[model samples]
Target: MYKYLFLLGSSLAVAQPAMAEDGEITVTATGLAQPVEHTGQAVTVITRDEIERVQGADVTRVIQRLPGTTFTRTGPMGSLTLLGVRGAPAGQTLVLIDGVRANDPANANAEFDLSQLNTATIDSIELLRGPNSVVWGSQAMGGVMNIVTRIENGYSASVEYGGDDRVTASAAAGMTNEKLEAALSAGFVDAGGYSSAASGTEKDGYRQYNLAGRARYHVTETLSLTANARYTHGKVDLDGYPPPNYTFADADVTEKLRAWSGRVGALYDVGILKLNAGFSISDTERVGDDPSYPYSIDGRSERAELFGRVALPGQLALDFGGDYEWSRFSNAPDAGKAHNGSVHALLGYYGDRLIVTAGMRYDDHSDFGGEWTFGANGAYEIAPGWRLRAAYGEGFKAPTLYQLLSQYGNPDLLPERSKGYEVGVSHGERGDPVYLSLTAYRRDSKNLIDFFSCWSGTAPLCATRPSGFYYNVGKGRAQGIEAEVGLQWAPGLSSQFAYSYTDTENRTPGDVYRGADFARRPAHMVSASLDWESTMGLALGFDVRVVGDAFDDRANATKLDSYALGDIRASYRVNDMIELFGRVENVWDQDYAIAAGYGTQGRAAYFGVRLRK
Candidate 1:
């Protein structure tokens, strides 16, 4: 039955008029600008309008609204935060900033920290869930998040001040003409947050500043050159164990992070063929100051890519791309360099009622040699106002430099691999009064690297390497159902509800923790929101989220209780150029911790205003 469904979705379907959702265009799915219907991937697009409506410093506030998505924060707003999808860890999610890979290569797990990003200067965001390594090269075993900064012709600014002595300010200006388009933006945030440890009394503080710029020059009617760059610097107070007790508690420590990325590309479009070529680079440095232990880590990555799509007869197109990337770490990895070269191709069929795409990628890594991945997805209109969709994708992640050459590294460690399959049915158009979707998905991963102990017995490098070593000895599987409903109950009023149920297990045989539930992954997650607008220039919104219990340790020795949180917001437009807004977060002051011994924020309120022209 599944094979028939896959074949039918990929090749067999009748022609008809395109649906409303097909009008939306995206570039993350297949590395080409195409209508949403052209790709068969599970994706979500967060528009700028929604970003403005949320009006929060932390972008995770809005990201958690999506089904099968969740985040855990070590402390308040600016502390270390990690996101996961379908029970996968943070390191498996690939993050891109204007086409530049932003994952830090110096980190042991090579994960992108969400705490370094906010909603200040973003124009739009695209989240591709599940394994999509065929389009994005590595670190995409879980998903892909593309953060596209604002590039518009206008002037806008905002300022906000609220609890915890938080102060926020941002501004952007741009110019657009026939031959040239350019923009620049900057933002700053300073907040006195609470301590990270629940038992601590000292308050931690966070500060960040960011600058971004974009430009595009049209040299001819069908040719254009584009460039964009971003830089961010952050400082956060931290807490750690003290010498006497060595317990998780408050201590005077601080960490600073600096990251910068840039991309330059050219585009050529003549209706029949579209091509995009670019070179991108990213660098990150982190310095931590502690009384007992101090450290510094620096990482750099560079990439060159070229991709294009050629339209053909019979409503078909061929998309192809290739990329070469190199990265290195300065500290723990001991200046080791890593390289990967990849090439991919996809064939897409676009019909009135059916849209499907199938692609494959081959990656050559300096450490692991070569790996191949394949992805396929399709959507078919079963009847008026109804559709069915299915997708299958494979992903792989090469061992990071820190994992391979660090003090506890094991050179024999191999790459991790994953496979994901999803199928779903939906009713009504995306903007219709009543729209609903239900999807079921499963993902399996092998060769997962975990920390191995050398205390009990002597392993290969255990004699010299007193610290534990990393080994490819873990396996995992996650299966889940996601449901979403959107309703326009009345004029100027709308609501949305999303729920996720995930079943995750440790699948490594003969392991003490095998068959146990995955750590930090809740079994159930629910979120709902309501928004209303009136002609009188007034808007009101409310959001509610409830998460189920989760274990903080794979051994299930520590449990993190489930909790519910709510927020209310309101905005009023004084005129076309000015607006006022405010929100009360944690309205009930529910005290809960996402991680063991981590403190959480209580009730907090904020107010702000915006000016645009």
Candidate 2:
């Protein structure tokens, strides 16, 4: 399938023009707006039009189509979902919502739950792959996902229903005037879902509600103030272990989560410099309720940041920034608090044919002292239709509050560190009708944190103990090649293809699980899509995804077989204000599992109607 798609794309590109204009501009890489093709890093941008074409209800569904990305979801919608980038752990990837950190501080791994995020209010998503700690600070050992919400003046609404008693509805409205722009969106989802356990028959259910708002006021021609806020509440019925323990049955577990975030900032444009300052706060609370026991965990983060970019003489530009963050975690049993301060400086040179960037950052943590990270990237336009890019960077991740102050916590844990590099070549411009890119990268990581039982005060090899402690004793390496091709064949016909080959291994020597592949991470992944829009207001789309087999446990005891999924969607606009759409997922109803004991959705169909201004 991949070979055929590649050939088809090549044939279509042969008749394309020599030069093409750039598409949307991105700011996730270096805090500066630049075309994705001009940046040295590997980045993927998903625009609003593409999102609507795909009919994705959540961010996870859209993100899964990107190269070198994978996700594990336990059950149906509203279930716990984790994302991995380039073979990196879920916690290593940083998630940002309009420049505010979204990772849960109370979680043992400080990972963000992608399931909590819906696409009702999102305008665009910028995925910066590979290590980006130099400018993003900690928890960027894998990559960064920056979500930009809609602030344009418009009004839209949608409603849909499908299998398993699923129902979804969303509404958004915005207005723009001479000096003010504001937008607000809200969404709700409820579904009677399948059980998490493979063999369980009892039906589990999930429900969620989300609301977001953004406002910007131009104080003057040279200054502006902006504010953004979001809230999400979710509940899911969980299936516990089926047998033996009997502590809690599969039908008696439920989990609830509430999260909210708010940010306020100001932007100033001077003669030769741009300045930005912001303050933000976010909180998440999760509660697990069982017939026999109930527990709750809460986390909060407060951040203040300031940055400036100066256009210097010649082709050089300078960027400098500083930030301070305070995080707290609390539960019935214990509480923890920590803070960190970071400062970074970046320099860039943008010439006629070459672009170069270098940056360094210093971070001081209240619990673990200080650390430094650096990065360098360059891109050269070898010809009108060819370009070469290379980048090298370092990354670090701090211990989470749960890992530091919980019952099984270790106060002596060290931060995980990593270094990686990538080189790539591409044919085409930023907005070329047809473009292709091939990239190869490698990353080596050390001091990865893992929980281990400690008995008799032994090291690396410990006996069974009632409780375990977090230790920085693991090492790993990931290498991969990613290829992407995209083309707009004609007026409304387009296609995209992406393939990735990943080689990952646990290099922790002297351990029982040494040299094993990472759990839930596929070694090979392929994604392809074709879409067509007719002049008569009709659109059709098809997508295919294939994932290679992977292990479900560290010991390689359980395996998840390879699976291929196909989906088709169509939309017809009745007029300028109304549209009808429908889609079929898992068209073949192939039975598969992304996790060991979880059940995946089967053939399902949904129909929806959209109304726009």
TM-score of 1: 0.94
The sequence of per-residue lDDT tens digits that candidate 2 reaches over residues 75-114 is: 7677789999999988999998877889999889999999
- Badly placed stretches (over 4 Å) of model 1 are 1-22, 428-432
**What is the C-alpha local distance difference test score of candidate 1?**
0.84
Error of 1 at 269 (Å): 1.3
Clashes of 2: 0
Count of backbone clashes for each model? 0, 0
Candidate 1 lDDT by residue in tens digits, 332-378: 33667888888899998889999888989988888878899999999
- Checking candidate 1 for backbone clashes, the offending pairs are none
